[model samples]
Target chain A: MLNPIEWSSGPDGEIPFGTPFPFSVPFALASPESPGLYLEGVRRIKERGGRLVSLWGSWTSGADPAVLAAFSDAEGLLLYRFRLSADDRSFPSIAFLFPLANRLERAVRDLYGWDPAGLSDQRPWLDHGLWDGPPMVPQDASFQRSPEGADSPQEEYPFVRVEGEGVHEIPVGPIHAGIIEPGHFRFQVVGEKLLRMEERFGFAHKGVRTLFRNRSVSDAARLAGRVSGDSAVAFQTAFSDAVEVATGSPPPRRALWIRSILLERERIANHLGDLGALGNDAGFGFGSVQFGRLKEEFLRTNARIFGHRYLMDTVVPGGVAGDLGRQELALLREECARTKSDVLELKTIYDEHGGLQDRFSGTGWLDPMLAGRWGLGGVAGRASGQMYDLRHSHPVPPYDQVHVPVSISRLGDVSARVQVRFQEVRHSLSFLDSVLEALPEGPFFIQPEETFSPFEGVGWVEGWRGEVLCWVRLGSGGTVLDAHCHDPSWLLWPALEQTVPGNLVADFPLINKSFNLSYSGHDL
Target chain B: MHKILLKIFRTGTLTEPLPEPGPPVKPCPLVRGSLAVRHVDAGSCNACELELHAFTQAFYAPESIGIRFVASPRHADVLLVTGPVTLAMKDALRAAHEAMPDPRYVIALGDCACNGGIFRGSYAVSGGVPEVIPVDGQIPGCPPEPKRILAYLEQLVSAENKD
Candidate 1:
C-alpha cells in the first residue's frame, strides 16, 4: 500500500501531498526557517521508501535564494535538466542526498556554471570539447564571457582514468561501420571479460534544449515529437500533458482515446521489432524472420490506416493533431486480430527453440535493488520487480478509466526483459481492441481557458520505453525559457554497465538490444 | 506440410536480383546488383528510422520502387542512418555498417543523422553521421515519412544507376 503524502511545501512548489494520498505533516518549515527541516523531510520520505520521480527547479529574477537553498536538504535524488539559464543561478544540488545527482549537477554546471555545493562529482557531461565562453547564457542575457581560445580547455576532458593490470582497452568508434547513430565506447577488458566500460555520449547532441528558447508552444511540441523519433506519440503526449497542466486545460475525450490508441500501437510496433531483433541475436533465424514479417505487416497496416507508419505528429497539445476514422479503425481491428493469431503461433515456435533460450535466459541480470537505486523505469525496471508504472502511479486521462495491468518479472535478465515485453504486447493488443470498441466521441481539441505566461509545465507520459518526462518553461511574452525531455534511458544506461558485468563481451549485443535504451532520448 | 511451410517462411526467399540496369553508369563494377535493407530504430521516437521504416511499410515498400530494406544490412547495398548517434551505440552502428564490406553505400537517415536534428546542439549528441565517418547520401527530416525517404533512396539508386 502507498503511504499518504503529508501537506506541506512539497518539493517543486507543490502544496505538500497535493492530492491527499496520506502523510499529515506534524509541522511546517518555511524557506526562511531551518533548511535542515527540508532535509529531514526528504530523509523521512526516503525512509518511507518513496522513490524519486523527478526534481524541477527554476531561476526567476525574484526567486529567493532561501527557497533554493532548502532543496539541498533532500538526499539521494537526481535532477534531470535539459538546459540551464545563462545566469550562474540554480537551485542547490540535491546530489548530497541522491548519488544520481552527480551527472545532472555536472550538466547544470556545464551549461550555467553554478556549481552546486557538496556534490560528490563535478565533471562536465555534455560540453565535451565543444563550447567556449560561458555556456548556455540565455540569448539576451549578459555575463562574464570566457577569454578567447578558452574553449580549448574542453579538448582534454578529465574523464575517469582506468588502471590495473590485465585491463587492456578496446576503443570502439566515434565512427562506427553500422547504420545506427554514433557514440564512443572505451571498454577496459581482461580478455573479453569486461572490467570497466567508459561511455562518451553527446556526439549527436543537437542542442535540442537551447533551440527551444525562442519557439512557440506549438512549434516546441513538434520539436518534442522529434526529440526521439521512434517514440513520437509518447514525447508529444508528455509535452502536451505538461502544457495542459500548466494551462489547466484537459484534452477532449476523443483526443485522449485516440492518443491512447496511438500510444498502444507504437508500443506494439516497437515490441515486435525488438522481439525479432532478440531472436536474431540468439541465432533463431526462424523467430527473427517470423517476427520481422509480422512487424512489417503491422507497420504496413498502420501506414494504410494512419498517414504515417510510426504515427508521427498525430498527437499534439490540447488534443491530438489528427484522428482515426471508422474505416481505419475497422481495418486496424482486423489487422490487430491477424497479428494476435500470428504472434501466438510464433511464440510457440520461440518457446520450442532451445538454442534461442540459452543465450536469452540468464544473459544480463539487473537486480531489483540496483534498479531501485538507479530509479530505473519502463520495461527495464519492471522486469526487476520494481512495480512502478506511470499508467497506475499517476492515472491520467483515458487510462484512468481502464485498468491497465502491467506485466512484471523479477529475473532482471535478457529473457526477463523479453518476457515482460511479450506480456506487455499481449496486454497492449487487448487494450487496443477495447479502446477501439469503446472509442469515445468528442472534440479533438478544446480551446484552453487559462493563459500561461512565463510559467513552467511538467508533462509526463508512460512511453514505450518507460516514463518520458518533459519540462517546458515560458518567459515573458511567451518565449520558451527551457525545454527538457528526460528519457528513461538516463537511468537504464547506467544499469547496462552493471548488467553486462558477468556476461561475455560477445553476448553484449543480445543483452544491450534486449534493454535497447534510447541513445537520442537520453542524449537530449 | 506445416513444417515445410515454416521452413520456407523462415528462409524468406531472395527475390531474383534485378538485372544490372543496362550498361551501369560509366565503367563502375562497384554499383552491383539490387539490394534489400532493413533499418531498426531500437529506441528512436520514430522521427528518423520512421522515415526509413515508412519506406517499406508504405505503398512503395522501397523494394517495389527498386530500393529495398532486407532483414539484414548484410544484404543491403545502402545503409540508411538517422538519430543523434547515441552513446551506447556508436560501435554497434559502425560494426553493422562495416560488416557490409566493399562497394557499400551510406545514407544519413535524417537531419538527426545529418546533424543530430533538433539535437544537433546537444551534449549527448555526436552531431551527424559524417561526424562519426563519411556519409554518401543525406536525407533531412525532423523525420521524413516513408514516401519522402523512398523518394530519396530511389534518387540515390537511380543516380548510382546512371553513374
Candidate 2:
C-alpha cells in the first residue's frame, strides 16, 4: 500500500520554498545580478567549516539564471553556473575559503581559462601540461586536447616544494611495480617514518567532462555511470538526480527502490573485495582466500540475478534500465543471506587473529578536526569518528524506508575502517532484505515529456567511498553543457596524504588498502 | 600434494566445476597471426592483478588454452590492460602499444579496465583501457568473475586456433 511518491517524500526529498537549502546556494548568486554573491556563498560555507566538496564550471553561454537556480535547489545541493562572454571581466575564486579548492581552481583555470585568484597550487590538472592554447575554449567547434607534443617532466610538472633536514625523497611511480593505477607519490622520508607526502595525480585525464558538451542527456547518463566502475550505481544515481531535477522526471517508486538496491549491492561488493585485499596485505592468507572466495561467489550470484557482475547498464536517467522479477528478487535475497553468513564467519576469524588486529589498530589516525577541514566522507571519515553517512544524513529512495545507523570509531586506524565496512555490509544486507520484502508493484520508469532544454542541475549520491557530487549542465536541445563528477577520492586522497605520516613505509599499503580510495574515480 | 588434498577436501570431490558445453570459443580477430599482451595499470589497488594472476595460478591453469601473458610488447599478441588509466600512465600506454608488434589485440579486464569505472574522473586516469589501446574484447566487473575471464581467454585462444 506504499505509494512510491509518498515513499520518496522526506526533508531531503522536499525542496525548501522560502529559503534555499544552506548546502545549495542559488544560481542567481553566480549571475551578473550578484557578481560577488558567489564569493559570499563560499564565505558562508567556509564560515560553517564546510569543505569545498566540488567546484565545476561549464559554458552556459545563454542560459537563464532563474531556471538554473530552480534546478540547483531542487536537488538539495549548492548549484551555480556563470555565463562566459567576451565582455565578462572576472570570475570569483573560492580557494580563499576552502584550501581544497586549490586543485579544482587550477583545473578550471587550465581547462576553461577561468581566472581563479589566490590559488596556492596552480599546476595543470586536466591539461596534462600539453596545450599552450586557451584552457577549455572550443576550437574547431569541439573541446578536445590539442595535438600531442613532447612535454618534459621537469618542465611540465610544477610540484610545490617541501624542504627539511634528513628528508630523503622516495618517489613511487606514475608506473608502479604492480599492475595498479599510475600515480607518483613523492614522500619525504627520514628512515621509515614519512615526514611529508605529495601526490602528483591526473596522469589519466580523459576529456570526459568536455566530452559531455552537446551530447544528449540520456546518452550522458550512460557516460556518467562509467565514470566510476565500483560506484557506478552511485554516479548514475547522482546524474539521474540532476537530470530528473532539470527535466522534472520523477521515477516510479519501484525504480527508485531498485536503484537503491543496486547502489547497496555495489557498496557491499567493493567492500567485500577490499576486505580480502586488506587481509592479504597483513600476511593473513587464510582471511584473504576466504574473503576472496566469498567475493567471487557473491559476484557470480550477482551476475545470475542482475545479468551483470558489477551491475553495469542497470541504472539509467529517470528510472532503472533493467527490470527485476519477483523470482530474481527472491534469488538476490537468498544470495545476500548466503554471503552474510560467510562474511560473518570471516569477521570472527579476522577479529580473533591478533596479528592483524595489532597491525590494523591505531595505525592511521585521521583526527576529526582534520577530517572536518578536509571534508572527508564515507568509510574513511566514519572510521576516524566523523559520523556522517549519506543514507542517514540525506536518505534517498529505499533508504527512507529503512533506517541506517551511522557507524563510527575514535581509534581511526586500519581496524576501525575494517569494522566500519563490516557493519555497513551488514546494514546494507538487512536493508536489501527489507526492500525486497516491501517491493511495490508499479511501472519502473517515467519517460520525459518535455523535449529537452539546455538546463543546469546537480546530482549528489553517497557512494561507497563517500559522497559523489556531480554538476551537470544541459546544452541546446538537451545536449550536455558540461558534466563534472567529483568523486569522494577528491577529499579522501588528500586525507591519505595527511594520515600516512609517522607510519612506516611498509605500513603504507595496509593503511592505503584500508582506505582503498579509487584512483580512476579521482583521475577523471 | 598438500594443495591437491586441500582442493579435494574443500570441494568434497576430486575435480573442479566445469561448464556445460555450448559456450562459444573464438580467437581474437586482431591477433590472427600471434599473441602478445602489454599490461597498463591506469589506477587500481590490485584486485584485477589477482584475477590476472589467477589465470596463471595452478587453480585456474589457463596456459592449456595457449593464452600466455607477455611482458614485452614486441613479443605480445594481445594488450591485456587493467586499472583505470591515470594521467601519468598515458605516455606509457601509448609507448607500450607502439612497441607491440603488428596485429595486436587489446583485452580490457575489470571495472576500471573497461571504462575507468570507479576511478573514472580521478586526477590520474586517462579513461578505460580501450582509450589507451585498440581493444577487441572488454571483460567488465570489479576484477571480472574468474569464469568470465576464463571464457574470454578461451575465445581468444579459439580465435587463434581458427587462424
Candidate 3:
C-alpha cells in the first residue's frame, strides 16, 4: 500500500514516470455505469491512504480532453491518466471517494467542459459566462473562443438553501469591501449565528492555463508565478523544477541551496503578513501595525537581495535567477536575527492578549475527523491533524540535505491555525539561520539545452499555504505544450465552508483570514 | 496596556512624507486635502493588493496624508481598480464605478489594470480596466510599490485641492 510513513523508493527521487500503470488493462467496474479505469484508479489510491493533491484536464490538437489526477502518499506522487474518447465527454467523478476532488472536478468541467460523471454540483465553476467555449482548447482546435463572450449573461449560481425560523441569507461579494481578491460568500444565518456557508469563486480567473500554453520556458515560468502572485517563488520553483525534470537537467547543488533561501524568505514574508492580518481580523489593530512594519522590513530586505520584493520569477528552469554571496547572506542573517526576536515578541502579544485569544479559540472549528477525510494539505491541514508537510516527508534537494520540522496540532480551530503560523515562522527562520552559514559555492544558474521531443515533468513544493504542485509537458524546442499549476487553496477553500458554520457570522472574516485561502490561486 | 504603550514608544513613528504632487488633472477645491478612495479588484493576482495593504502600516500612514480607503463607492472621490478586467468582473467593476458620485476619477493601479499587463490575450479577460471603464490616470508596474501608489494619489489630491 501507499502509506505516507515510508520514504519514496522510486528511482528519480519520488516523481513516477513512464506510461501510467492505470492503462495497463481496461479495469472495468461491474456496475452498469462501469465508471471504468478512472473510478477504479482513484479507489485503489484511496484504499492506500493517498491524498488527492490535484486534478487537471488537458487536450491535444486532434484528441478530446484527457483528465489526470495526482495523488500523494509515501511514494511521493502517483499520477492517474485517463484518456477519454472524443465521443464520451464525461468521466467518472472521484469526488465521492475523495471529497477534496469535488471542486477540482467541477473546475475541470468549467474549463474544458468535460463532465465529471454523476457530480452532484454541476454549476458553472470558472466559467462565469466569460467565454463561450472551453478556453483550454486552442482557437484552431476544439472550439472557437467567442470575442463577444461578455454578451452572454452569467449563469445564476445555485447556492444550497437552508430554511427555518429566523433563518435568512446574506450574500457578500465578488467585489469585497477589503482590497483583497474577489470571491462571493453566501451565508445561511439566524441572527448572528451562521447555519450554513457556501463559497463562490472564479471572479478572479484570468485563463492562466491558456496563457501558459504557447509560451517558452521562461515566459511560462513568469506566467505560472502570476497564477496566484503571492506564491510566486513557490510557483516559479515548482514550474522550474518541472521543466528541469522534463529536460533531465538538475541544477548544481549550490543552486538548490540558494533556491531554499528564497523559498524560506517567501514563507516568512507571507507568514509575517498573514499573522498580522489574522490578529487584526481578531480585533487587534496593534497586531497589524507591529507585524506590518516587520513584514515591510522583510520585503524591503528582499528587494535589496533579490530585485523584486515578492521575488517573482527568481526561480527559473535549471536554477535560480540570482545567488546569495557572503555579503548578501550576512545582511540576510542580520535581518533574520532582528525580525526573529520581534516576531517572538509580537507572538507573545498575540498569545497573551485575552481578547484575541477569546475571539480565536473555538472560532471556526474544523473537526479533525472531517479534516483527515477530506485530506486537507498545508498549514490549515497541519492545524487540523492532517499532519503532512512536503518539506519533511518528500524532500527534493536542499530540504533533503537539511532537517525540516513539521508543526502539527489537532485543535483545528482558528487559534490552532494561527499557532501553526507562529511555530512555522520560527521553524523557517531557524532553517534559514542554519543554512545561510555556508551556502555551497558554485554557479547559481545553468542554461538547459532545448529538446524537440515531447517530455513530461511534475514538481511538488511546500508553499506557504501548503503543497503547490505543477505538471508540465514540453513540446518542440523548449516550448510549453500544456501546463497546470495546482494551488493548495483548492483543498482549503472547501474546508473553509466546514469551519464557518456554528460560528458567529461576524467571525467569518477572522476565520477566513486565519485559513487565508487564496481566491486568485483557487480561481486560477 | 503598559507594555503595549512602551512598545509603541520604542518603535516611535516611521511615517515618511507624501511626495509633492505634479499632474495634468483639473484643480478643484471640493474636498480639499481629503479624498475617499474605493479600491476594486477586477481580477488581480493579489500582488497589487498586497502593496495596497502597505498603506495600513506605520511607515505608510495613508490617513496622515488625508487618503482613506472607503468600503463603499457611494462615499468616494476616486475608484482605484487593479488587474486585467476579467470577463466575470466587467459588470461588477462597471456597477461599482457607476455607483461612485460625480467628478469621480478611476485610476488603473498596475500594468494589468493599465493595459492588461501579461493577462492581455487570455479568453477570460475582456481587457485592462480601461477597456471596461474610462480611467483618468494609471500607475503601472507589475505591482507599483507603496511609495509610487502613495505618490499618484497625492497627485490626484493636489489637483483636487486649490492652493
Candidate 4:
C-alpha cells in the first residue's frame, strides 16, 4: 500500500536512487538539495512504517563527504545516501524528527568534520578533547599520535545539572568494579529515586572506522568481526554480506546455513551469560553459578565444533571458514536439547522465585511508545512490545528457509527483558536444530574475484543484541573507499537513559545489566 | 531446593590442577602469597573479558591456583590489562597502574594488550599496555583461553618466587 516515489533534484545534480532490491534499496542525493530531501525521505519512511536503523558520515580522500542512513521498513530496508561538495560541508539535522539521530549526528560532526546544523544536543559526543582535531579529515592521517602536552589538562565534561531540594549527583566510572568495558554514567538523584541519568561513552572507541579505510574486503572482514566481540559473528557476517553484495557474489547455500548456525550459537552463549548476570545482580547467586556453567559448556562446544570459542574469523567474505561434520552435528544436537531443557527449568525457577520477581518486575520500565519513538530493537525492544526482528521481518537467505518466531512482551521492565531472553534462547536452539537438520551439501566457501567494480553494498543482520547494519563502498580492485559499521547499541543506549529515571539508585545495576548495551559497540 | 543442591553435587568441583611452578627467580616474599589481579580494559572488543570471565567460572577456576580478581588495584598483586589502550582510557589505565602497591606485576592479556592486535595504529588508540604502563608478562591470542591465562599466571608467580 506504501508507494515509493523518487525525489526531484535542483540545478546542482540529480541524485541517483537505485532500484529497490528484495533486501535493501540504495539511493543518493546531492549537497544542494540534500537537507530538504533527506528530511523528506526520513519522513516518508516513517510514514511508510519504517524505523531508522543507523545514520553515519564517511570522508574519503578523493570523493566528497558522504552521509548514509539506513531504515527498516515493511518491504525491506531503505538506504539513503547524500554526497556533499567540498565547499559546502553542512547538512540540516534530522534529530528533531528522530531523537536517536542526536548521537549519530554528533559522531559525524566529531569524526568527519561535517556540521548537522539543527541538532539539539550539539555538545561533543565522542570528542573528549583527548586529540587535537577531527581525526577523519582527508588531509590529516587520522591515526597519528597527539601533539606534545595534549594529554595534560583533560577537558571537563559539562553534564546537564538538575538542581532542587534534596537533589544530589552521583558519578560512576569509566572503570567499573566488574570485568566490563569502561563507560561513565552521571546520575541526578533525589534521595534514592533517580531523577535523570546521562551516559558518556567512547572510552572503548579505538577509531575502528578509521581502520576500515583502504583495506581489502577480506582484511576488513577481520576488523569488522572485532567491532564488538560478543557480536563478532553477526558483525563479520554483515560485513561479508555487504562486500558480497557490492561484488555481486552470493555465497554458497551451505555457507549461509553454517553462518546462521554460528550466529545462533553466539546468541545462545550470550543469553546464558546475561541471564546469569541479571540473576546475580538481583542477589541470586545460585542462578549465576548454574547459568555460568551452562554458558561455559556452550563456549566449549563452539571451540570443539568450530575452531574458536567466540567463532571469530569463521565467517569470511565469500562464505564461512568452518564446516560441521556428522559427528559435530550429532554432538551439537544433543547439547542443544540438553541446554533447552535446562534453560526451561531455570526459567521456571526464576518465575517462582519471589525475591527475583520483586527486584525485576516494574523496575526500569520503558514505555512501548517511547521504545517505538526511539526505534529500539533486539531483546530490549522486544521486551518493550516492539515486534521487529530482522530474522523474522527481513529474512535473508537461510533465515527464509527457517521460521524465526519473534518473542515479544509488553512489560518493558527487567523481568520482561529476562523473559524475552529466555524465550529467544529456546527459539535459537530450535532454529539451530532446523538449520543443522537441513544442512545443505556444497562448498563452505567460494573464491571471490580478485578485482571488483566500484559499487556500494549494505548488510543488515539481527545480532543477539539487535540489528547490526554495515555499509561498504568498494573501489576498483576491491579497495574499501568508506565503511560504516553501526551497532544496535547506538539506538538502545539512549533508551537505557530513559528507563533509569523513577527507579531507585540501588536498582541501577540490575536495570543496567538487564539492557546490557555494549559500550564498545556504541563507542565504536 | 533439593534438586538444586543435587544439581550442584552432580556438577562437582571444577577446580583444575595448577601447572608446576618454575624455579624461584629471587627471594621475594610477595611471590609466596596468592596473586590478586585488578583488571583494566583500556579498549577491547570484550572477547578477552569473556574469556577472563570464563576463567573465574567453575570450569577453569583460577582461584584454585591462588589467582583471583580483586575489585581494587591496591589489593592486587598483579594488574591484568586487556585491549589496545584507547586515548580516552589511557589516563584511567595509568591511574589504575599507579594505584597498585609496589611488588606489582602487569600482565597484558590477549593480543590487543600485548601489541594492539588488529587495532594497532588506530586513531583513538595508543597501541598496547606497554605504551602507557610497563608490562611484566604478555599472553597472546585474539583472546587467550582461560587455561592459557592461568598458565601464564603460574609462570609469573614461579619466576617471581625464584627471584
Candidate 5:
C-alpha cells in the first residue's frame, strides 16, 4: 500500500491527512499551496495513466471550504482535497488546465461563494440569480438576508453570441415538449448548419446537497438515492459505502452481492430505455416499441422482486433493505437469458436496417482526444475510445471476484454509442449469471455503530451513466457535517456541446439521446 | 421485410379497457371529450417521467383511451406537472400553466408534486406544485405507477362523461 502521509504532504508543509477509506485515497492541502499542488497532482495522475473521476466542494462549520477531486489510477481511486479559507476564498482555476474543472469551479462559486480566480466563464451555475443569498453557506446569527418583498424581474441570462452573416440564435426550453426534465439549450446556427451550442441547466436543482446536511446517516442515504432516479442504486451504494467506511464496518458478503445485482439491474434498465429512445429519435418506431416492451418487462420484474420498479430505498447505510430467495434468483436468471436472446436478435435487425444506419453512421462524432480532455466516461466515453470503466479498473468486492469487459469503439457517433450499449448489455447479463450462481450465504445487513468519530469517507461507484463519487464527513454522534454527491453528467454535458456543433438541429435529439446525460444529476 | 411483417403480426394489440373513475374525479362538462395533456417537469427526479412514458407503451396505451400528450400547452386541456417546484423552474411552470386555454386542468403527479416528498422545505425547492400553480388533482407515490396515472385520467374522463 502507498504511504498516505508521504504522498499527501507537499513542499509547502505537511497537509492534514485522514484515514484512507476503502477504494479512496484522501489528502488535504493547505489553502495557500492548494492550487499548485492540485494542478501538479492532476498532471502526475494523468501522466501515470489515471482518469479524473469527479471534482466537488464540501464546506463544514468553522472550517474553510474544501474542494475534493477524485481520480482513478492503476492502484485504485485517489482523492485529493484542497482547503480554501474564508478570508481568501479564491483559488487558481484548474479549468485553465483541465476542461472538466470549468463547470465544477462555477458550481463551487455558485453554492459556496468560493471564486476560481482564472475561470474563463464566470457565469453562475446552478444559480439563476433568484435566491436571497448563497444557500449552501452556513447560516449563523450574523448571516441575515433582506426580507422578501416584491418578486424581482427575471434575470436575463448572458448566452454567448456568435457573429456572422446568416447566423441566428435558437433558444429551446427549460420546459420541453417531452415528459423529460427541464433544461435550456441555445443553438447558434446558419440555416441548417450549426455554428455553436450552449446549455443552461439547474432547473431541477432541489437543494440536494444542502438537504444531506445534519441528517442521520440512514436519512441521508434516502436523499442520495433520489439524486438521479435512474442511478438510484448506484448513488445509494456509494452513500452506503461512504457510511460503512466511516463507521469502520464493511457490510456482509451477502449485502455486497445484492448491491451488485441491483447495480446491474439498474444498468440494464437504463440501457434498454436509452436504446429504444435512440431508435425512436432515428425514426425507427419498430425498435422503440420492441425495446420499450422489453424495458417494461424488466421493470415489472424489478417491481415484483425488489418491491419498486426503480428500486428506490433498497440500499440503506449498512446493507440493502430486502433480500432475494431461490425462486426469485432462478426467475432473474431465466429473464436475463430471455432478454439476451431477444436483444441479440434486435441487434442484427438494427445493424441491417438501412435507414437507422443512414441516420446513425456519421452523426455526432466526438473525437477521442476531446473526450479524454473533457473526462467523459460511461457509454458515451467508451464509444469515443476512452477505455476507462470503473467496474474493470477499480473493482470492489463483488466486481473483484467477477470479470467486467470494457466496451469501446473509435467511431464516436450515435451508431458507436448504440453498439457500446448492446455490448455492455451482453456483458452485464453474463455478469449477473456468474454473480447469482456464486451467490454467497450470509446476513443481508448489519446495524452500524450509532456513534462515529469525526472522520471523512468517500464512496465511488460506477453508475450506469458513469462514475459517481459521494464524499461525507460525520460529526460526533454521526450527524452529517458536510456531504457532496458528484454526478458524471457534469463532464458528459460539455461533450454534448462539442458534438452538436456541426450536426443539423434536427439530429440534436438523436445525438442528445445517444448521450442521455441526466439534467437532475447535473442540476443537483 | 417478411420478418418485420411477421413480427408485427405476431405482436397483436396489448391495450386494456380503461379503469373506472374514482370518487375524486368529478365530471366537468367542458372536458367531455378526448383529453390532451402537456407534461411539465417542474423539478422531478425523472422516475415519474419514466412511469409516464410507460403509459404510451403497448400494455397501457393511453392513446387508445382518448388521452394523448400534446407538444404545447395551447393545444393541451390538462397540465401534468411533476416534482416539487424548484426556484429556477417556478417561472417556467407558471408560464406553461398560463399558456393553457380556459378551463385548464392541472394534475400533480408523484409525491414531490403533491407535497414535495423528500425534497420539501429545501432552500432551492418551493415544496409541491400547488405552491407554484393551482392543482386540480394529485397522483401520489415516490412515482405513481402507470396504472395509477391511467386510473386518475380515467377518473377525469368519467367525471366529464357524468357531466
Candidate 6:
C-alpha cells in the first residue's frame, strides 16, 4: 500500500514536517525532512522494495529550496521531500542503494549544483560546460553564454579510457548517421566485440526547468507534451493530472476514458513503428516497410479522428482538448481491430523466419538480475523478466475499471523486446476495445480556477516506453514556479548501456532499436 | 524467403506522388534534379525526426523520386537540420555545414529548426538553424507531415541535370 508522505509541522501550525499535505493524485505532501530523517525515509522505502521513479529539485518562490524523490509502491506514488539549507552543498546519496539514481543525481548537480553526498562517480552527466554554470537560479532575460563556453566536448570530455591490446574506441554521434535525436556513444571495443558502451547524452536539453517557470497551466501542459513528442499524450496527461491535483480540479469520467483511449492508440502506433525499426536494424528491411506502412496508416486515421498525428495537446489540463463523437469512436475501434490482426500476421512471420530469429534470439541479452537491480520496468523490463506494469500494479482512475494484461518475456534480448512490443500492441488494442464499448457522457473539460496558492503535486502515467512523471509547483496567479518531467528513458538508458557489452558491435543498433530509448526525453 | 516474398507481393506499394508546392514556394538556385541530403538533429524533441523517418518509409518511398538521405555530411548536397540549435549542438551544426562540399544548401525543417519554435527563449537553445549556419529554405510546422515535407523538398528538385 502507499505509505503516507511524512510532513512535520512547526509550532505556529505551519506545515513544517506531521501535518499531512494532500496531493490530488493518490495523495502525498512536501515536508523538508532533515538529512538523517531523509536517509531513514529512503532506506525504509528501499526496504519495502519501492522503485525509484524520479528525483528532482524544486526552488519555489517564498519557500526554502527542496529536493524531492518519487518512489513507486503498491499504494501508488509516494514522495520524499528533503529540505536543503542555503549553506548545504550536498544531500545523502541514494545512488549507492538505487543504481538508477546515479544519472539523475548527476543531472541535479548540473542543474542545481546539488551533488549527491558520498557518491564516487562525479563525472558531469547532463552539463557539457556549454553554459557558464549550473542553471539553478534563472538568469536575466538578456543573459549570454561566455565566448569560450562553446568549447567542444569532443576536445574536453574524459570518456573512460580502456587500455589493453587491440582495444580501440569508436566515438559515435551527438549527430548519428540516421535521423534520430542526438547523443554521443563511446564504445570501447576489441575488434568487432564490444567491451563497454559508455554514453554521453543531454544534447537535446532545451531547458525544461527554465521554460516551465512562470508559464500558465495551459502553456506548461503544451511544454510538457513537447518534452518527448512521441509520448505527447502521456506527458500531457501526467502534466494535466498534476495541475488538476494541485488546483483540486478533476475531469469528468468521460474525459478520463478518452484520455486512456488516446494513450492506447499512441502505444499501438509507437510499437508498430518499433516492430519495423527492429527488423530494419537486423537487415530485414521488408519488416520495416510492412510495419512502417501500417503505422503510417494508423497515424493518418488518428489525424482524421483526433485532429493531430501524435495526439499532441489532446490531453489538456482539466480534460481532453476535445470529446470524440460516436462516429469517431467507431472509427477508432475499427482501426484498432485492423492493426491488431495486421500485427498478428507480422508476429507469425517473425516467429517462423530463421534468419531473423538467429540474429535476434540471443543478441544483446540483459539478465533478470540487472533489470531488477536497476529497477527497469515497461517493455524492456517485461522482456527481461520484470513484470511490473503501472496499469496493473497501481491502477489510477479509469484504469481501475479497465483491466490491462501485462505481456512479459524472460529471454531478455532483442527478440524478447520485439515479442514484448507485439504482445503489448495486442493488449492495448483489447484495452482500447473495452474502453470504447460504453461511452460515458459528461462535460469533457472543466475550466480551472484563474488563480492558485503555492502548492506542489505530482502525476505519472505508464507511457509506451515506461512510466513518466511530471512534478509541478504552482506559484501565485496560477503560473508555474518549478517543474520537472522525468521520462522512463532516464532509467532505461543505463540499463541499455549494460545490455550491449560482450555482444558483437554490429548488434548494437539492433539492441538499441529494440529498446528504442528516447534521447530527447532523457536529455530534457 | 518465398513466404516473405509472397507477403511483400500481397502488400502492394502505398507510395504516393509528392504534393505540389504552393505558389509562394521559391525555386532553389542550385541546379539539381535529385537531392543527397544529410540530417543533423541540432536539438530536436524527435517529433521532426519521426516525421522525417516517416517520409522515408514505404508509404513515401522517397528514393523513387531521387531523394537519398546520405550517411555523412561530406557526401551531401543538402543539409536537413531539425530543432532549435542548442548551445551544445551549435558547434556541431556549424561543423557539419563546413564539412559539406561547396554549393551545399541548408534546409531547416520544422518550426524549431526554422526559428527556435516553442523552445525559443530557453537558455540552452541558441535560436534556430540560421543562428548557427546559413539556411537556404525552411519547412515549417510543429513537425511538418511527410506529405508537407516532401512538397517542400520537391521545390529543389529541378528537371535539368542528373547527379
Candidate lDDT scores, in order, read: 0.63, 0.65, 0.81, 0.82, 0.82, 0.82
Q: In model 1, where do residues sit more than 4 Å from their true spots?
A: A1-38, A55-91, A142-152, A156-165, A450-452, A475-479, B1-30, B34-46, B50-108, B111-142, B145-163
Candidate 3 residue-wise lDDT, A74-159, digit = tens: 75677666665556677688889988788888788777667787778767677777676666655666553323222244567889
The most accurate candidate by DockQ is: 5
lDDT of 4: 0.82
Per-candidate total of colliding backbone pairs: 58, 52, 0, 6, 1, 7
Clashing pairs in 5: B27-B159
- Model 1, C-alpha of A149: deviation from truth (Å): 16
Candidate 6: stretches off by over 4 Å: A1-5, A8-27, A30-32, A138-155, B24-31, B160-163
Ranking according to DockQ, highest score first: 5, 3, 6, 4, 1, 2
Candidate 5 lDDT, A294-334, residue by residue in tens: 89999999999999999999998888999899999999999
Q: lDDT of candidate 1?
A: 0.63
Task: Give candidate 4's error at residue A296 in angstroms.
Answer: 1.1
User: Model 3: clashing residue pairs?
Assistant: none
Q: For residue A324, what is the lDDT in candidate 1?
A: 77
Candidate 2, superposed: residue stretches over 4 Å from native: A1-35, A60-76, A81-90, A132-135, A140-156, A160-166, A475-477, B1-38, B42-79, B82-88, B94-145, B151-163
Candidate 3 chain A has its poorest 10 consecutive residues by lDDT at A23-32
Residue B65 displacement in candidate 5 (angstroms):
0.8
Candidate 2 residue lDDT tens string, A48-80 = 554456765555445321212111122234434
Residue pairs of candidate 6 with colliding backbone atoms: A2-A75, A7-A17, A7-A18, A8-A16, A8-A17, A8-A18, A9-A17
User: How do all models score by TM-score?
Assistant: 0.80, 0.79, 0.93, 0.93, 0.94, 0.94
The 10-residue segment of model 2 chain A with minimum total lDDT is A1-10
Fnat per candidate: 0.29, 0.29, 0.86, 0.81, 0.84, 0.81
DockQ (C-alpha based) per candidate is 0.26, 0.25, 0.84, 0.79, 0.85, 0.82
What does the lDDT read for residue B16 in candidate 2?
A: 40
TM-score of predicted structure 1: 0.80
Q: How many backbone clashes does candidate 6 have?
A: 7
